[model samples]
Target: MAEGFLRPSNGRMEDEGNKYFNDLLANSFFQYVKRNECEIVTSCKMHDLALQVSKSEALNLEEGSAVDGASHIRHLNLVSRGDDEAALTAVDAKKLRTVFSMVDVLNGPWKFKSLRTLKLRRSDITELPDSICKLRHLRYLDVSDTAIRALPESITKLYHLETLRFTDCKSLEKLPQKVRNLVSLRHLHFDDPKLVPAEVRLLTRLQTLLIFAVGPDHMVEELGCLKELRGALKICKLEQVRDREEAEKAELSGKTMNRLFASLAHKQGTVLSMIFWRVVCAIRQKW
Candidate 1:
């Protein structure tokens, strides 16, 4: 996704770029590929041979030690046990393009001005700096399995952001309120069922949302806006649905999905039947 950032962004490069990534993996360039329940590659470990081939360009900074080419480093891997940022003051941040941190705690000012991809999965970080809005060139961000509670509102201003992930963030309950501002988002991989923000339906280009929790504020009908949704989708709070009319507005008949799960009302009623009908229609069109 980071390499897909091109001039005159028409948004087709990401799909093309993903193909290259898949091919490289098939050719044994990468290993330990991690995927979510919906089969999205959340992370990967570069093969040792491949790492040696790109060693000059990438730097695996352990504990921010003074490396030989710290000034020219573009890709950095924080392999320290977690905390301590004392030795990193000399490393320039303007030229950094990617950062993968295994640190348990991330400190210091968020100053990666030119960073493109950031992966902090399983980190102990609790919050993001408001200064993260400075990453204008960022295209991919993953904070899966972290302890962060919320994303700073400044994140919504990243119009060029293509992929934003918070999968398995048990403490992070919801996405930023103005998520509609991410006009270029393609995939939103998360674990929370109720992470839907206001005007999420506006993201018609979105292709991945494995869990859809229907809250009173955001009804089931909003699913109609995501015509491209595929794979598995679990709908919680189906009882809040008003009636068959509201459920019908979801337009799930044409959606090609492998699985669609919903919690219908416990008691038999019109709402229960309505929920059941929608689920059946969705299943019939499974991909």
Candidate 2:
């Protein structure tokens, strides 16, 4: 392991042998968790640091004394707006793994075996920890309204995840390459043009596939591949104006996009007719 360096909030680096701030951080981390719930283990260190301590004395101590294993931490939310330290300090995520946060929550491979759902919407998080993929029992993951740019390659490990929402994740650029492994996903939502790469055709089990910048001319053929689509899909593009040529191409692709809708509309029935009409209107530039 690399030696711990004392990097303070003022953007200055201290000596690696500086045990003063290091011990201060350890104490502050422990005190922060104690002040919050006193029943969970939380820390403000980066995932690397948190993971290090999580596997070492700090987390083990918390597990033994604060909470009985990972069973007590049922809900966790780190602060949405703060310096890295403040955000890290707010995270008391310990044994009770079923968690909800708008912060970067996955500090380490989820050790809690009973965790089933995780919600981290609007937390300004950027990357998902690869350790998250270890949660085989996870059923829900919401990362809406955050600045998250992409998912980890290991995301396909969540075999039990059913509802995955990424609403308003403006910076997200691509889905995990292993997304095909998410055969259990029922809802996949995003509205960033960068997020809708052609690889999206892999999600065959998606019921609600929301995208940005869907045009009649842009891979309408791929829409037919999502055979499990049973709910409404919304396509959004910001600031770009729609023209007649775009409308015509969408009208042509509308035949297929609408057919995909027909399969889904059958299950949802008239409730979706209006929604599909709105979708068609958006694609056709009638909006």
Candidate 3:
């Protein structure tokens, strides 16, 4: 609905686009369910009548709908209810641009040629099938909070991928070493701080890198090359920084980083002073 209201002159909406949402709440179209201590509504439950009306207009291919009538469907969400495995197994939506699933496990020799976004958050998928590399057009993928352990090396073939998220995937021990080949990558979210490789300097287009652990293989100076970094950055094991010169080379002040958290393994007065001054400079620039 907000997309429909964008101005024809600029293709952008002037407001935050909450007017329709407020109107719905005012007219009792949606029931408020939860609120924060500040009295801000946090959750809303749509009236059953509205839900039914929405389903009546949308084609849910997962509900035993015929694929013959779904060739034009651009979005597909496969929500499993234990018995819905057969429904997922029968899906053949090649034209689908988005595919989201919330299932314990996905059983597939799957193929979606045109898919651009794939999210399988919290699923029991332990590994991505080799066929996933065939998605040449895939741009966004989130397998966060899952039981995955390792990603196939073929994942490096996703040259067009822009954002990859695997936060809270505790069992994942490593990422493809050639991940830097993804030149288009802009956002990378991971749970383990040590998982980031020094080769990340190759991803000069990166904007959001949540946790960076300084280690023998990944030096803090490597961060100097990532001038596009934004948002918050948490650099752990700061003791690995060789000297003040190396810290200066990180170029933290050159970027638009808003928040920074540094954990030092050493408490030497000189080192601490240098780090403190650099951080203060960065913070001052942010302000």
Candidate 4:
């Protein structure tokens, strides 16, 4: 984890981080698994000898007597095997800052006031407690790969949130109408294309919008206002756009978007010709 060691100040710093990873690979500190000619390193395993050394060093650095429980733990990761809800509910991590739950169920009267990041990936949580809105200091919230059908309207009260990720949550149909109130949001990753609100244009600070579906209320031209968007962008339901002039008004060339995909709900050559293909060509050349 290059968290504190690497600060991405520019492109060169990112390259340096990659170079450091490669150096570890070359030294056999990290092993690669190959499929065909492609090699992908999914995880790093510590050698038994190395693990012993690290454990001894950690013990040496320990300054205080062992606590009775995890009451002082600031970061908690709960990986549920089965029926671990009772164990999870018993935790009294009052000073917690980060909580990562890779579980199927999360039952909570959760009251972590200082919590900043909460990740509940692949969880079976159908709904979040209204108490979540009380975490004013929260910044990163991820509820991806879950069965949550809807978010409580009180979620709009998190004014300090910077990243809100709900990718692959197929059951989620819509976002709160007042989602525009999250003025600090910089990244919003969602699955349902139609869930995007017409007021998305007000999120001028947004940078990573995964998908945008053009509809009667949210026109293609609304994308033009998101000048800060970069990386990949998928524009679905292109059949709704009237003509090429309207598509061009999205101003794809003005931003730093590298990968662009445009899809039509229905195959209409005239609409595709006027809006879709031309936009793709413009993006291909711009990047």
Candidate 5:
């Protein structure tokens, strides 16, 4: 278990001084415990447990000493109040297996050769680097409650990914067409009220889908193609169904997708802002 607080030395700064920093430290300690044999975990011992702070202050003063080689560390989490440029620069993501949470990903060439999973919850992140497509081993990603607008076509390269949650990505318009290539995906959550994209039916392995809509009818034809979704599909609008036969067929067979709510309408711009926010809130509560 992570300690509630880390007491600082020199009677200097209290953990209360920076809540985000303290939280990161506590989480890092727990991570170290999970991966005890890793060398970087050993180095976390140098700083006084109570007085210990972030590694950015401890090992970043020198250049060649760290940020490279056998002493190199991975699985980092620096979700402070602002952009964590220090953490971004210090660790090599290509060798990383996990990252707790980060804000912006709009810096330098993000070349994560072997990265498997990344989480950026409750951060200020607005856009993803097109370079994100380079991670051949990536399997999981979460970018909830951020300002991101859309995913790049390059995202199709993550063929191995299984879960992707873009909940509360309010500004997102549509998913990239290449999304269909993620044949391995099992769960997906995107809060866009736009028509469910036609590309989704291609992900034959998908089981759980949380979707918002511009009008469910917009992609009704494509929805019929998803024969593999055996779990549930929580959609924003049920009124989009123009074909009663399709709905009835699936329901009668007892194999139809589960609907969270039965109806929705298509109206964009600020005039529909109230409805949009209401549906978004409902999705969050359900999730």
Candidate 6:
């Protein structure tokens, strides 16, 4: 997806992408697939037999070492394998594009103006420099399982960003307010659905939103506006909904998803018994 290899010209990109992926899996190109409760593949590993054929395409660098030659290098994988610190010493970065890092980048900033993908999953990093706006071509960023608490507001400047995943970052508070400015955004995966920005409905191209929490500032209809949404979605704070008319506006019945979960456990007198009953019936009728 980061390379636009599965991008489709029509319909939802994820739908077409998943079809191609299943084809590859059925053909024995992928192995050890892991699926979620919704039966969606979450992770997978390539067969070692297939790895040998593509070994030359991937270069393995030693820990705490300086880069020697970097004329045609585009991808760098520094996912921590041990306690050694990964150093970016003597590296001549000119046009590097991708970086998968799990260790603290030391020795230098290792900033490459042409960098495209940056995955810092399971790292000790805390914050991103506001200077990240310089990566105009950046398309993918995954900071899952990290200590990062906040993202620089300048990240909204990357108009080309399509995927921004920060899942499992327990300390993170919320997404940038100007996130809607990322016109090309297609996916926003986070751990806390309540932390999602209120203006996220503006991202019309969005396809995957696993959870949503209705609040005073957000309406239930916001999820309905995202026509491309798919996969599993859990809607929390269903008691916040006012009436059946409002719930009808959510159009949950027409949503093309695998499973739907609604939680009204916190219901209070705030929702009248008669109104709430009609509202539940309205939504269920659609489903």
Each model's C-alpha lDDT?
A: 0.74, 0.53, 0.71, 0.70, 0.56, 0.74
Cα lDDT of candidate 2 equals: 0.53
Instruction: Tell me the spans in candidate 6 whose CA falls farther than 4 Å from its real position.
Output: 60-71, 81-93, 265-277
Please give, for residues 1-287, the per-residue lDDT of candidate 4 as tens digits.
11234556665333566678778667766564333211224357655554575442122112233323445556556654443444434445456667777663335555677777788878768888776788888888899998999888888899878789998998988888888888878788887787786589998878878899888778878888988777678889876776667777788888877677888787676645666676556545555
Q: Rank the candidates by lDDT, best first.
A: 1, 6, 3, 4, 5, 2
Q: In candidate 6, what are the lDDT values of residues 1-287, reduced to their tens digit?
A: 66667767786666788898888889788988999877778899777776676443343456644545534556667645543233344334545567777765522456677677877889778988787788888889888999888988899999989888888988998777898898888777886865777587888888778778888767888977887777777777777788888988877677777787777655567436567677767766745
Q: Can you tell me which runs of candidate 4 are displaced by over 4 Å?
A: 1-68, 81-92, 103-107, 269-275, 282-285
The clash number for model 5 is 3
* Sliding window of 10 residues with minimal summed lDDT for model 4: 56-65
Kindly list the per-residue Cα lDDT of model 1 for residues 30-100, writing each as its tens digit.
88899976566878999889989887668776763666546777787777753335424445667778888
| Model 3 regions lying over 4 Å from their true place | 1-69, 83-85, 89-91, 104-107, 265-287
Report the CA-based lDDT of candidate 1 relative to the real structure.
0.74
Which segments of model 1 are wrong by more than 4 Å? 5-14, 31-39, 42-45, 63-66, 82-87, 104-110, 242-245, 265-279, 282-287
Better of 3 and 4 by lDDT: 3
Error of 5 at 192 (Å): 2.5
Predicted structure 3, TM vs. truth = 0.72
Q: How close is candidate 6 to the true structure, as a TM-score?
A: 0.85
The candidate maximizing TM-score is 6
Worst lDDT run of 10 residues, candidate 1, spans 82-91
Backbone clashes, each candidate: 0, 11, 0, 0, 3, 0
lDDT of 3 by residue, 50-135 (tens): 76775532335445445444444566666553434454344454665677777632355445777788888877688987667888
Ten consecutive residues with minimal summed lDDT in candidate 2?
256-265
Which window of 10 residues has the lowest lDDT sum in candidate 3?
A: 1-10
> All candidates' TM-scores?
0.81, 0.49, 0.72, 0.74, 0.59, 0.85
Which of 3 and 5 is the better model by lDDT? 3
lDDT value for model 5: 0.56
Pairs in steric clash, model 3: none
lDDT of 6: 0.74
